[model samples]
Target chain A: MGRIEERFTALKKEGRKTFVAYLTAGDPDLETTARLIPALEAAGVDIIEIGVPFSDPTADGPVIQAASQRALKRGATLAKILAMTASLRRTSGIPIVLFGYYNPILSYGPEKFAGEAAASGVDGILVVDLPPEEADELRCYTDPAGLAFITLIAPTTDPVRARKILRRATGFVYYISVTGVTGTAAPRADDVRSDVERLKRMTALPVAVGFGISTPGQAAAIAPLSDGIVVGSALVRLIGEKGTSDDLVPAATSFAGEIRRAIDAACPSQGKK
Target chain B: MIRTQPDRRGHFGIFGGRYAAETLMPALLELETAYRAARRDASFKKEFSFYLHEYAGRETPLYEARRLTETLGGAKIYLKREDMNHTGSHKINNTLGQVLLARRMGKKKVIAETGAGQHGVATATAAALFGMECRIFMGEEDIRRQAHNVFRMKILGAEVTPVDAGTATLKDAMNEAMRDWVSSVRDTFYVIGTTAGPHPYPVMVRDFQSVIGREARRQILKKEGRLPDLLIACVGGGSNALGLFYPFLADPAVAMTGVEAAGKGLDTALHAASITAGRVGVLHGNKTYLLQDEHGQVRDAYAIAAGLDYPGVGPEHAWLHATGRARYVSVTDEEAVEAFVALSRQEGITPALESAHAVAWAMKTAPAMAKDKIAIINLSGRGDKDAETIAESREEKE
Candidate 1:
């Protein structure tokens, strides 16, 4: 199994919910991003979604969009992000998913990107704009390279289409908790719970709820409803606010640690029958 | 015979596809189904025709510019007078069609993105006529540049939302509009102004605007006893160009040219010449030639004409360029300005700066061709809104 499937399987067996933390690569610079990876892992982050900044992030809200601009202005490219991943692989075995739009990957040459990304110890990739109908080109390469192609399921997705999307899905399903862009509005726990339950019945793949998830209270409320929760714009917003500080790593770790503790306390999956 | 393109899945030779957020996919699919049904429903066709003819003033003239031909001293030049449309541009053609579709789909709110504000004004006007809520997303830069159109949109009862992101131009406005659609998909209808965006949109907009080509084809045959030797139009997101070019795609003898805005020069980091100085990449939900950096980050496109300041071209234009069916060229801001003034003086017709790019290229090429050969420039919009910008530019030059 790939690292993504293996990680989910191991977590499921342990009766523990996962925490996926996202950070925009090269927000201030790659070195700070490198430092935050281990920091996030230390704070109980299960998977790391390194956002590859694009000039136009239409799917993101103001927080992530501003973070992307900062990263792009700092001269971050897909090549540098991959090199950072390769370097990070030397000391860490954390599952890393490169998250961004498709244009950068298309610019990198899909075949070459798939090969190099796999060689760089990347686990999966979630292209926000590429739906299953248009994913064949990138999947043809990433699938053979053992890289999981993470698919997003929106609230607007009808069940019939969801089933089709799930069938082709390899990695865990990313359930966008809201219909709007990331971090724009909070997802209601009641609304997310039923969707998570419905998704669980459809596929064996783990369902991770993301988008508009911020505070520990929200995380705690959502933790028991899904296999995992992705906190992106929240963490990205924090990093943007504290990136220039001397204690940026500590601040990020503590912030993520609060949400991790909240999830574990709320779910308490360990030792459950 | 019609030249079929965009197939059912909206692929124009692998250039156009539905590359959008998952939240918007269902809406796109819903739109496609509704559009397919509307295409077949005779009532929908009749209503669309009624609005085009009675409301938006269809059948704009195809007038011969004898003075322009004499000044250029070459091929006889004809002007396809899209400027005489009800809203002062060809944008009304697509807006009226989409607004009608929105009403048929039971949508009560309509939103659109505009750079030059022509599309925004068109959408606003249609919404007012239909009694629907209207909102327009315009870039901050464009809003400042095209204050006249912004005021027109406001006067038409549409809320103008300024997008402060990403160079504050048409691309940013489009991004903001898509974001709005994502959240408001249940009730709001996004009226894309150009022949870009995902499936159904490019095809739908092109279909609505193709009336220009159909009328020109018929009128040219009557006036010249044959088809024109060449057709010229400026390409922003390429709606006007495609409108005039789609009906003639199957004609082997007729030639077409799309002019892109080279803001300063192609060598500089500034031009909007996507097909001429761009690489094949995806943007605004369609795969096309885009102005992007080596790292695949989209570069901000610059043009004095706000309408032509987008970094990407329509996907079909990319396909047409790739297949060698149409030629694409670029004209600098200076050349466009010269043509803008020349057309005003020679023909007593003030062309929008966007359309002046086409006039500039025709001036260069038509002079080299035989006098008997004919060329038609799609005067995509009137320049009343651009009078201030032109005056300011002239002042700077002086």
Candidate 2:
């Protein structure tokens, strides 16, 4: 099994819900990102998502968008991010997922991206703009390269369409809790709960709910419904607020810990029969 | 050489496809089905043609530029005056068809993205005609540059929403429009201004705008006794050029050229010449040549014309360029400005700065061709909306 699968499986055995933390790869700078990863892991993050910043992050809202711009301004390319991931692998065993848009991978050539990303200790990949219908090219290489090609399902995904998207989905399904872009408005927990319940009945793969789940209270509310909880814009917003200072990591770590504690407290028992 | 229709999956030779968020796939597929059905329905065609003639003003004049032709002292030049249409641009051709499609699909609201406000004005105009609620997304910079058009869209009953993300240009406006569409998928229809974006949009917009080529073909044959030797149009997202080139694709003898906005020069970072200088990448839901950095982040594109200052072109244009069916060239801001002034003085026509890119190319190329050869330029819009910018540019020069 891949790192993403192994981590989730281990978490299931431990009777715990996973807390996935996201940070832009070169947000204030790559070194700062490298520093934040271990802090995030130490703060109880089960899995780590490294956002490869792009010029046009349409799906993202203001917070992540600004973070991406900061990362890009630091000259963060796919190669640089991959190299940074390789460096991060020396001391940390946390499963690293590269989240980004499709153009960068396409520009890097799918085969090259897959090979390099896998070699860099990256465990999974998610391209926001590339839905299942157009994901074949990237998947063809990623699957063979031992990188889990993650899939996303939104509130708008009907049962029939959800089934089709999840048919070959590996790792986990990212259920976008909201209908709009990331970071705009918080999603209703009741709506997300129903959607997660519907998805759980259809597939054996874990479903992680994300997008618009900001505060620890919201994370606690969503934790009972899914295998994992991905918190992105909220953490990125803190980083944007704090900037590239010495205080950045501690604040982010504290926030992650709060969400992690909330998730662990809410879902005390997790291993399924 | 004649096979140009997109495949069932909407791949225009690996360039165009339905690259969208999972939330949008169903809507896109539904739109594809509706558009395909509408295309085959005779009444749909009849009504569409009726609006084109009676409302948007079809068959806009194909005038021979006698003064320009005489000044060039070479090839005879003709202008397919799409600028004469209501709303002052070729944008209405696609907007009218889309609003009609939205109505048929039982949608009550329409949304559009604009660069220079021509498409916004045209979409607002159509929404007003159909009595539907309209919202137009424009880049913050464009909203400021084309302030008059923002007022025009407001006057036409559209909510002009200024998008401030990602360079605040056409690409960001498209991103905002897509986000809005996803938010309200059931009741809203996204009328993409250009022949770009995801599948069905490129094909549908092309079909709607192909009337330009069809009429030009007939008009040229009737007046000149033959097809023009060359066809030229400015390509931002490539709607107007594709419109004027689609019907004539089968004619192996007639050459086609698309002029890109070279703001400073191709050598500099300040140009919108995607095919000329950019690498193959995806943006706005389609794989096309994009002005992107090595990291695949879309770079800032610049041009004197707000309409042409976009980072990517339509996927069909990517296919056409790759296959060598058409040639893509670049003209600098100075050249386009010179053409804008020349057309105003020489032909008593003030062409939009976007259209001036093509006029610039035509003026340069037509003078070198034989006197008997005919060259046609798709004058995609008028310069009335650009009067302020033009005046500002003149003051800057002085």
Candidate 3:
């Protein structure tokens, strides 16, 4: 609670919106992803969310789901993902958050996961399907080990649920930008902005907007209202089209710079984007 | 004595094997070795017995059904009352032992699949007792029909995740639960609640449930002076029947009879009479007689008893049937109802509709045997839960 609160205050004082970039660890290739991660942090990503692929990802849309399949087919496992993070930890101290559903986490026992994630320089984890009510034991591992567990709050969540998430969540609260699966929509600028506004009244935890935000304008629009804007499929979609590691690195950085500029102007007093 | 040593490589004579996902192989092997070691150790059995008696409430009474027996007229009928076991049905016997095994193995979470919600309730009970997290996967339809059990599970601190793909019944729920088990075998114990599924589970669950037969053996010997002429019990996955009959297979004087629900009839599309109308194929991790199509789609089979309506019997039962160690028979819905009413009036015992099929078979068969000879039916569950369905179906039958 204290770390997340402190992070929010620091980011607010700096007047820089958080830039979160999510990518499947072994999506294109495990080795390629290892190189891609540090570059992402350098590209202005405040936090890196690396997805550990599973066979069934109920919450993700077709593009990310296909990427997960590709990752898993190349023998993408928890060990491989952990090994990738270990390699990336040499020089990178940027907060790394492992993201996936419960299956992979349960596959890798919780205590072992916390120890390894801490060893590999991972700061947090976000299980997409394990809601706040269900996340207590998972946090038992993370809290004792000093690893952050970022929790998600959906559009469907009522006030009580919002409070429950507020009480239960650690690290940063993931404010899903829309009603449904990831990568299925282009961002709705004002709706996301209002959702973030609604969340601010409830909790002091830093809110990072995720799900449908893609392109420079949407990121720029969301930046003003949020502590961070999480960009996932849009970047993965870019990598898929280019189909090469060489150009994708520079492209990711350029996109981050664009989103960063939006965050610069995205203050409460600055008015609407 | 129980057949403790299965084989060198976990096979029960080419029937059981650890053919699963690559990740699960190590965990399955570990479970096999631990189970073997635990059974051999004396202290483990002593503790299990203590829990079986104190915590789980074993050794349910065997009551004579005077009306049911006289109507059949073949032999005197008695019911080994498993329905009276704490938490209802024989499922708790296996779950308590398995949860203890899970703690011994140092696993902390419990996961299982249930169709009729009985197994789910039992697993949830064990999880609550051990103070371990529990998750049960049930079909979407079952979640609605067994909604009370769903609430019961949640109140007991187990999460009931509704599986909503394919047929969305027992088999599909099993598939979903297995998928979770394969990935998370280290942290969780997969508590299968029957004498079905793959290797070790069928054998393991049967052994836990052997309390049913062990108790019945003692009770029948004391009550009847000699073992009954025929030992009749219902076969769904064959846990209660196997628990009762398998121990007495060596007792040649006690003829073993397994009653399967005739369902609608022997007509392949209607009933759950697997041994009578099914072929040998691999389903639910065991090579056994199954009610499945050529392409391996599990067909919808019906029975008055929700528990006995499953399409596959345990492989060990198939072997027993093949080797002539046991005889298999089927009882229809109307006949089962008559037995239900007869037991309710004669002995004031409301047997589970599934267990009623066995009582029904006993009623029909006992009359033909010499009156001096005794017949015992495994009354696997009490009908307290079925008071509503029994009343309605009793009308539907009339």
lDDT (CA) per prediction: 0.93, 0.91, 0.76
- Candidate 1: the clashing residue pairs are none
* Each prediction's number of clashing residue pairs: 0, 0, 10
Please provide, for model 2 over B1-398, each residue's C-alpha lDDT reduced to its tens digit, 9 standing for 90 to 100.
44645888788887989888877888898999999999999999999999999999998999999999999888999999999999999999999999999999999999999999999999999999999999999999998899999999999989999999877988889888988887888789999999899999999999999999999999999999999999999998999999999999989899999999999899989999999999889988888899988767788899889999898999999999999999999999999999999999999999999999999999899989999999999999999888888888889989
CA shift of A103, model 2, Å: 1.1
Evaluated against the true structure, the overall lDDT of model 3 is 0.76
Residues B263-289 of candidate 1: C-alpha lDDT, one tens digit per residue: 889999989999999999988788999
How well is each residue in B1-398 modelled by candidate 3, as lDDT tens digits?
A: 22543455434554444434323444666787789888998888988888878977876888887777776766787878888887778888888888889988999998998876788988999889889999999988667556667888899999999887544566667767876775466688999878887667888898898888888888888986777778889998888898888678778788898999887788647788889888665555655677755423345557767677677888788878877778999988888888888888878888878888988887777767898888888888877666666677767867
Tens digits of per-residue lDDT, candidate 3, A1-273, equal: 333445566666766677888888776788878878887777667788898875555466656766876776677778778888887878776678899865456546778888888887777888764554346657888888888878777665556657766886678888877655677766677877787888888877789998888877787777777888899988777766655557877876777777666666555543222
**Residue by residue across A65-153, what tens digits does model 2's lDDT show?**
89998988888889999999999998899999999999988988899999998999999998999988789989999999989888999
Q: Residue A176 in candidate 3 has what lDDT? A: 77
Query: In model 3 chain B, where is the ten-residue run with the lowest total lDDT?
Result: B16-25
Clashing pairs in 2: none
Query: By DockQ thresholds, what CAPRI class is model 2?
Result: medium
Higher-ranked by DockQ: 2 or 3? 2
**Number of the top candidate by TM-score?**
1
What is the two-chain DockQ of model 3?
0.02
- Best of the two (1, 3) by TM-score: 1
lDDT of 2 at B224: 90
